[model samples]
Target: MFDRRSFLGSAAVAGGLLPLPEALSAQALAPVPLPPPDLYGKNEDAYWAALRRQFLIPADVVNLNVGTVGSSPRPVLKAIFDGFEQTEQMTQAGSEDYPIWGYGSWDDYRKPFADFMGAQVDQMAILRNCTEANSYIANGFDMKAGDEVLISDEEHGSGEMPWMLRQRRYGMVVKKFAMPKPPKSPADILNRINDAITPRTKIFFVSHISTATGVVLPIKDIAALARSKGIVSAVDGAHAPGMMKVDLNDLGCDLYTGSMHKWLFATKGTGFLYLRDEAIMDRVWNTIATGGYDDPTRKADRYMQIGSSCIPTLMGLNAAVAFANAIGIDRIEKRNRMLADHIHAEMMKRGAESWTSPDPALRCAIATVNVPPVQRMELQDWLWKNHKVRIRGGNPSRLRLATPYFLSKSDIDRFLGLFDAFRKMKGVA
Candidate 1:
């Protein structure tokens, strides 16, 4: 178990911040052990409950906002702390070897994540966050004046704004296709992309899973379509890495970027950019220039030459990948789908309009609904301040509920019950 005093004392020394509450401190300091392998076969519910102990969230609190960010679990935190302790000692075997990342290939850290994402180490570049990776795609990619980059209407600001910035500064064109509010099938989305493409379209850039409605786009089909037209395919997959099974080789996109911190439960500053091959790498210029940025022989490592960065964060990322592998991503994906399906169904029963897809293949982990007359901000505030339940949504209506594996069915039930009470309190049916 981590020492509570040490943790609290560090927080105090950092910024004179108030110490965590006793219950929260105890929860943070508690031992986190994985349940026995056989126990899952015997009692699945009990197995999940046991696994929940690994998280720092208090048992009484329900977190339905993992779409925004995830709390790092005990194992990841331990690895990060241990890394800091070992590296800060300033005792290296080699006289010139330093602890900082971003200079060398750092294959030990990059390979594990590359294997997890089904890519070779040469194709992966460990970046700071999804936004930086997106900027790399937008600003670094070779484009001429009036060369169009097509995207969807549902992209997050981080994904879309970079392109917008490029359009303002340079002379490139940015086009958008409106995604179906709730796509019933893959064809519904494919048709939109097909229609949106023009002769001048140089790049097909879109989100693998939309941040707005949590709808999973058909990336494989989109990539193929772009390939047939000789347009480069790039994806902003910020929410796809840990939320579902991602095989970049299978997806066959020219470029892909994602954040491990969102659903992967890794340290906050962990993200990556994947270039499909050397051909694509050659087309992209370096946004952050350093000594090795222009080195063709370095492959994907060339993109990682962005000054000095914390090595401990990469350690946390390795631990996160290990944790997910231990639990089995297939198992985690199933639980995510099951919980999301349950909540989506319950919301449908309550007459909420679905923003997420009805096709199970097009949705996972996140279930978005439009509950009109509910005042999303008001309900969000009421739930967190009064009920210890956390949620996120937009104005007037629209709830984007993210269901991670740690939550139980009863946790969903509690939220549903509270939803009824709140509706009644507001005199809405």
Candidate 2:
């Protein structure tokens, strides 16, 4: 219902050029409702079809690249647009009150997401993005020049680069452990991590889900191992929150960082840094300082003092959380795994070797495969330009397919069919 005319009209009004039509404005801001509860009991496929209507992605275009980013559903978009309208009016009861997000403890916005992530409001700091949170961990955590931070070899650039930058500038040691190409069990990963640790190991920083192969690491075991050794455990959970259920307390990690924009389908700039307690918080200096940056009484809120930021984005984040809650994360996770397993099985049948974990518990929505004798860039361009199908992968072979709950099995089938057609065309079938 978001038309070009209404968008332009709103922009014009913001510029003091013209008044927006009341009906158009109302239509633009209206919330998209979830499918009725009874629909799920009647026809599960139809229920998912109804839920799929909530997304703005065109019916013809299929997006399998949610690992890189996600399309926010209509309800979250509505909340952001509505928030901007309400906040831009600039009429406040308190003379000191402002619309910016980074100044004070905005418990109203923080508490809902905190509860969703299984953490207290005092332990969560609303940050701009996962990269910023990772940078904060690397640049702010107390470490001696020769101290080591052990990480997996398959970390995302954002997760790895910050530590690399720190190492280059401060002379800290960055250590790496190779992950099994397709780990058959949790012990395969755990043993590598254990062997990599030494006396100088100050931190065990790894991803909850591997960004490269889409493998879910054994985080609880990793956290326990770190705790036993008195090494700080930090997780780059950028892809975990919406893909599966996350409980920070249960995971028992000292620190965690993630982005809501990727899988949670929240606003683009929303992310968080979670500190377990005051002891961990004290070890990290504020990366971006303001008035309350050094205040211990503020708890995790003190880290959020990074000057002015967008409040409408946080509003969208809350709406995203509500949207997931309405559908129930358990149901969403099940659907995600089913779709991923389906795709993985189909790709295996096509002689594509699995890069994702063989263990179901070690893999979730993302299903990675290595298809040799076919150039990935060539196939990637062909699928997108010709078939309107989008996928992401590395050169030579690897394909990382992300299955959001919104995608139907038929969508995966279409991609599979296209893959067959492409292979046949190239004489690689």
Candidate 3:
């Protein structure tokens, strides 16, 4: 039985703050019904434009950097504020006197978020961020000193650092394989990864989508291969959950971790981890053990047993998932991809060479282009300073444009016009 008094004492208000919403019970704080999105609309732009209104983005700033982080929409913001008030109020009222009953636990957000990601409810954990989730998997797995781990050169630091740390601590061998700039096909990706695997390989670590090149790797095939080889597989999927359809069971990875804030437009510091086999929960040692560590019934949630977290952020994450659900993932995927494709075509017309793969199968909502005429940093600064258009420009000297569902075709067109002017200014031959 939960000690109601202890829970309330731990959750008390800080700095003489006002009480949060006392009605933190499931029934009292039930999610509000979202407005129906009209699927029958013929004007796609108009419909998308209306949807864009729900966000608090300034009219003058065009954000093509959702791949880095997304701005939470109005509904999610409202939920955060409401959750804060409710939690404080509940703490003030004391668990004995409060009308509602049950653990107003962060775990309440788990199932709905799990459903959103096409994962089992019992297999999910409310982690701090993608990095934390990845770290949990890296440190938890029992690997021998000489065990081998294979990963791509394109992986983000978060994906690579954990293995590197393990290598330093455990003498694990880490190998980096080269991936084609524009992959030939799915087989091509699979073959490259397969060719790299050796008898000593214990784990195959890769990204669902490479943030640098914005290329969608063949995660399903890779995961299946790992299972056949008796090797553990983990996917650094920080970009996939909301930007695309992420069916973890279908993907078949032993572990998959991602951030809700990136494409999901959830509050910052919200992320999750999905473990395919619930039994493996005990094998992976908890990095930070807390109350739920010893309970076998806790399942995958044992990884999330950190002491004291922001309750409102977890509630905000639920709202973010609800917001995305209202739009429908399939529809969101299509709209976002269409925008990226449009940008890809326009960049090609401007004599820009794409760093991202040309194959539709290998590319999704993120498009990276190398504009040779002007320096990438110069172009990025010009766009942000002159046009207030925010896109990512980084290593390998390429500009990454993230086509979110909220972005319109007109916005991409405007970006293209500015890009062309920059090319002309540079006197491209």
- Each model's TM-score? 0.97, 0.95, 0.88
- lDDT digits (tens) for residues 34-114 of candidate 1: 999898789989999998989988899999999999989989887887787778778878897778987889999999999
Residues 363-395 of candidate 2 have per-residue lDDT tens digits of: 999999999988899999999999999999888
Please report the TM-score between candidate 1 and the true structure: 0.97
Instruction: List candidate 2 segments past 4 Å from native.
Output: 1-31
- Candidates' lDDT values, in order? 0.92, 0.92, 0.81
lDDT tens per residue, model 3, 1-429: 343333433456553554444443322234444344563266677777777777767777899999899988777877876776677666645445342212223456888899888888888887889999989878877778888889999888888998899899889888988888767688878888889989889888899999988999999899899989998888999999889988888888888999999899999988888888865676567777877676767788777777667778888898899888878899889888888899998888777788787787788899988876478788788999989999896754589999998888888888888887887888865
**C-alpha RMSD in Å of predicted model 1 compared with the true structure:** 1.9
Judging by lDDT, tell me the better candidate of 1 and 2: 1
Supply candidate 1's per-residue lDDT for 150. 97
How many clashing pairs does model 2 include? 0
Q: Clash pairs of candidate 1?
A: none
